[model samples]
Target: MLRITAGKLANALRGTVSGTSRVAAVRCLHGTEESAEEFDKRYEKYFSREGIDGWEIRKGMNDLLGMDLVPSPKIIEAGLRAARRVNDIALAIRWLEGCKDKCGDHQATLYPFLLEKISPTLKELGVPTIEELGYDKPELALKSVYDL
Candidate 1:
């Protein structure tokens, strides 16, 4: 369950190894032929002050979707955390929407917990709950896979 991107993993390894060594380690560990220069550039951007933002998380999720990979709860959670860290409610809800749409019934088990995590932010922003967003049922707000 290596849920994070290679660049993130590489950046984490930087505490133990130099950046160049980390890049080499990642390359060797993953058996990737990507050039050191490319990895360096990618990691530099990835480890910047902003780190990985919600947009990048969305793009990564989209890339996985484009590859026909169904997102697991961990993937969805990562995107949600990124969206929340960036204070992007629209992106948070977009990830929620993706969970509903792409994850089907499997998403139900996570909704209550996810809602608990995001509810404060929603409240702070004065955003309406899914029920107020035109959903007819409370359970549907947590468990429904279809958009309201």
Candidate 2:
């Protein structure tokens, strides 16, 4: 019995098998290091582009929020503006939550700053803040866990 992979089969057919899987993973696009400001600007531009759709808005917000540092206010404003333009109020709210989550322990300070910075845009775009949406205090579990 013998086992040969598709790569080997292809190589044999082509008269050579340099081999596959064992090849060292090459790092693509090691061009330059991106700064936090540049990263923020990139995402801001993505959301601020005219005629951006819901899917692109979600993807851009998600990818930006998934990064380590919290998104800057300008970026969040752009995303919120885009979300409203795309008529996605839910996505706009979700992005607010994502930004809050990314704030970690500094949420006490930074979150308010973020809200303040984006409040005008949110209002202009007719998007509600998490508090205005009543999501600032979730009451799904009324009593303490010990009550359960």
**Judged by lDDT, which candidate is best?**
2
Please, what are the lDDT tens digits per residue for candidate 2 over residues 1-148?
A: 1356876787776674233411211111235556667767777888888888898888887766655568888888888889888888888899999999999999999999998898888888888888887888876948778888
Error of 2 at 69 (Å): 1.0
lDDT of 2: 0.78
Off by over 4 Å in 2: 1-30, 145-148
- Backbone clashes in candidate 1 total 0
Query: Which of the numbered candidates is closest to the native, going by highest TM-score?
Result: 2
Candidate lDDT scores, in order, read 0.57, 0.78
Q: Could you tell me which residue pairs clash in candidate 1?
A: none
- Relative to the true structure, candidate 1 reaches a TM of 0.40
Candidate 1 C-alpha lDDT tens digits along 17-49: 766664455456556667645544443344232
lDDT, candidate 1, residue 105?
70
